[model samples]
Target: MEFVRLLLLFLHLLGMGMLVAMFFVQRRAGADAPLNKGWLHAAALQLLTGVALVGLAPLTDQEYDHAKIGVKLLVLVVIAGLVAMNVSKPKPATWLTPTLAALVVVNTGIAVFWT
Candidate 1:
């Protein structure tokens, strides 16, 4: 169970990294790059792994803090929603990646710095 938790954590971070990477790629492409499948996949993985991590925390003998988890979950939902909304667009809104990236960073900060 501990190993499973670790794996989920890894996947969660992988998804976060993927989001940041896509943000950079989109910025570099300068509106030429549409939201790719990678974005959706990453968002899904991030969401799934995050929930699973919370569910599995008890198995690892960790206490679940509902407040922190709830905040992070809310941010992730926004990130996922943004990705889903833009995935099918021929040209996503100019603020999409910037907003998503900022939210991602905010979530990460919450995860790392929240008590």
Candidate 2:
């Protein structure tokens, strides 16, 4: 189980990297550029890994602060929403990439500093 958790964590980090890279790539390429599939895949990966990680750890109100989980989950949902809204576009809105990157950073901050 720990091994699986670690693997998921690894993939989660990769997904984050992909998302951030997508933003940089988008910045370099123009709003009219076709969407990159990698960004959407990363969003999905983060969602899946994050849920699995919670299940693996099983945070309880009595033990760990579940509020942090809730907050993170909400942020993840927002990120997922962003991905869903932009995934199929031939050319995504100019705001999507930077917004996605900012949201991901916020999520990361929540994960690290929530305790």
Candidate 3:
């Protein structure tokens, strides 16, 4: 179980890194399609793996009470909402990607330090 947890964590981080890199690359290239697909896939995978880990972990109520976890979840929700909103419209890759990347980093930080 510990090994599984670690593996999930590793994959989650990898997905996040991919997302951030895709965002930056897209921003530089002035292209959105490739980055959008990559970001969507990475974000979906991260969310799935993250939820799996949380379900598998032996967490107490006190652990759930931490502000960091709440903040991270809120960020995740915002990211999801943004993704949904932008899925149909065409716009410059400015705010959403960076914000999502920042949230991913913050989520990882909270997972590492708060737990």
Each model's lDDT: 0.86, 0.79, 0.71
TM-scores, all models, native as reference? 0.92, 0.83, 0.74
In model 3, the clashing pairs are none
Question: Which stretches of model 3 miss by more than 4 angstroms?
Answer: 31-35, 59-66, 113-115
C-alpha RMSD (angstroms) for model 3: 3.3
Query: What is the full ranking by TM-score, best candidate first?
Result: 1, 2, 3
lDDT order of candidates, top first: 1, 2, 3
Task: State the lDDT of candidate 3 residue by residue for 1-115, as single tens digits.
Answer: 6778888878988988887787677677664543366666777887888777777767412224447656766877777777777766666456766777777777777777875
Query: TM-score: which is higher, 2 or 3?
Result: 2
Q: Highest TM-score: give the candidate number.
A: 1
Candidate 3 lDDT at 62 equals: 22
Candidate 2 regions off by >4 Å?
A: 58-64
> Stretches of candidate 1 above 4 Å error?
none
- Compared with the true structure, what per-residue lDDT tens digits does model 2 show for residues 1-115? 6577678889989888887888888788877887777777788888898777777775321234589888878887897787777778788887778878899899889878887
Better candidate by lDDT, 1 or 3: 1
RMSD of 1: 1.2
Q: Comparing candidate 1 with candidate 2, which one achieves the higher lDDT?
A: 1
